[model samples]
Target: MSVRGRRASFISAGVRFIVILGLSVASCWPFRQSQDIEFTFLLPPGRVECFYQPVAKNGSMEVEYQVIAGAGMDVDFTIVSPHGYLLTSDFRKSDGIHTVEPTEEGDYRICFDNSFSRVSEKMVFFEVILDGQGAEGGGDDEWADMVEPESMLEYKLEDIRESVESVHRRLERSRQMQTLLRAFEARDRNLLEDNLWRVSFWSCVSLLVMLGVALTQVYTLRSLFHDKRRVHT
Candidate 1:
């Protein structure tokens, strides 16, 4: 539009940027913390894990996982939803940390399933560290207290029971898949074995046919030679 209007727009944009920067700096100052949560579960089937983490609106989790185990089996992770939906992996840190930012606010269950191979020892051990929450406002003690601490994430268990069921359903699905694969392999092996004797029998018959053809050719050649000898005589 007009020069004055254009100037006003630029000034307005600059002011908004300054305001955002100021708020960001103030938030980093940090005052109080919400809560700390920590809990562990012994996986009956395989290793499963969950940690309360605050993810950015567009960033990874505010809480990060650090896994340690033999062959990192302690870190072998499978994620599932309580609603019978499978969760996908977003990112894994160099230290075998997993992080994801949820776009929706609701109950989410992540299972660290290691129930693939029966031979594999059902071993999965892992822990996570949580950072504080973030928003445009500076975290006040009142606000922080309203939130849960990173260390005390156990309270979510009661709140996430349905999520646990979701995990169970996912595990069931995994089991089904494994069973199907095994059946397929068995069928393939049986098919191969069933045809083995037939294949061998046919191969022997073909060999016999070739031998007979050779013998007939030899007899025909001998007869021709004897005729020529008689003519020479």
Candidate 2:
């Protein structure tokens, strides 16, 4: 074969190999669709706060919560179904995980009640995860609008793109996990510091009280031992 022809053959072979690799990667990529929300908020005393989330029938909903900072490290959590049924109820709980599979398609309500608290407000960290058909519907249309493979090479390229997108999603998840960790650590540190301060304050107060008692006793003894009759004479 001519040198130019040989070079062309090698380039074609390389392109084919690259395309095949891309297709394989895409075929192996994993896809998932869901909705998640996280937040930290303060619930004031004598207040009732509620949030709503829409979910499709047969969908799964999960909630996890912790009292990050509060008067008692506990709060009231309640989840109501779309059909006006109470799914989960927790009173004066520091942390909990709740899950439900809804049978109706409608807006579900989650509430944090602080009405029972007369003076203490609560700071809470909570997350909700919903896995439902409705959440995946838009994703399906997006996938359909993506470029279709016209040839085997294009097919491989599409696969490569999917793999890359999967990687991107993983990295995003990792970042989110890191953020959550930091928040948890900060909350814990604050609690620790507060407890330490309380301990120190009490220790100082107890020491002063003891010293006052000792001084008072010493003065009382000196008064008792004094010769008042001799002084009068």
Candidate 3:
């Protein structure tokens, strides 16, 4: 090949490689239509708090909740479907996880009830994960239009895309696990602190009682001894 033709061919090859790599990365990028909500709320005594989440048909929903702080460390939880059906209900539960698959395309209700505990309020931590709803990625047609039908680049791109997707899924799971662990840790810490406070308060009260009794005993003994010495004299 002539110098100019050689240069032209090299430039074309470089452009093709770049295009393939770009398409691969774009297609493999995680375009999740999923919604993740994490919330911590206080449920007052004699009250019920409810939240709504809209989900599409054939989608999946997962709800996890924990009563992190309260008198009893428990609350009543309920899930209602779009059609006013009760899907799950738990009374006086400390923690729970619920899943709904192939959900109806409407609003779902989640409620926490603290009416039974008329004196103690509750602190709740909850998470909702909605998956497989409006995912929008994978530009396969764009890749096909830019590459030859049987090119080696196409196969390499497919491999790269799969690898990227696999890594993305693993990372997502890892993140979810970490979040759950943090919630648990917070609950445990709160419990420990509460217990410690109670113990310290009672210890102080007992110490004060002991000191009062000891002083009274010492005074009574001195008075009795003084009376006896006077009678002897």
Candidate order (lDDT): 3, 2, 1
Error of 2 at 66 (Å): 1.3
Q: Which residue ranges in model 3 land beyond 4 Å of their true spot?
A: 1-30, 137-155, 228-233
Error of 1 at 41 (Å): 40
Candidate 2 clashing pairs, residues 3+ apart or interchain: none
For model 1, the local distance difference test gives 0.45
Better of 1 and 3 by TM-score: 3
As for TM-score, the candidate ahead, 1 or 2, is: 2
Compose the digit string of candidate 3's lDDT tens values, residues 1-233. Answer: 89999988977896788677757576555455667899999999999999999999998999999988888999999999999999999999999999999899999999999999999998999999898886665344544555534544244655666666677777877888898899999899999999999999999999999999999999998998775444443
Q: What is the lDDT of residue 53 in candidate 3?
A: 93
Estimate the TM-score of every prediction: 0.31, 0.72, 0.81
- Least accurate stretch of 10 residues (summed lDDT) in model 1? 62-71
lDDT of 1 by residue, 1-233 (tens): 99999988877876666555445434443432222333334444443455333332332332223332222233344444334465555332212445444433333455555444344333223333222334334544334444432322233322333344455456655764564455445445544664786699999999999999999999999998775444443
Pick the winner on lDDT between candidates 1 and 2: 2
Q: What is the C-alpha lDDT of each candidate?
A: 0.45, 0.78, 0.85
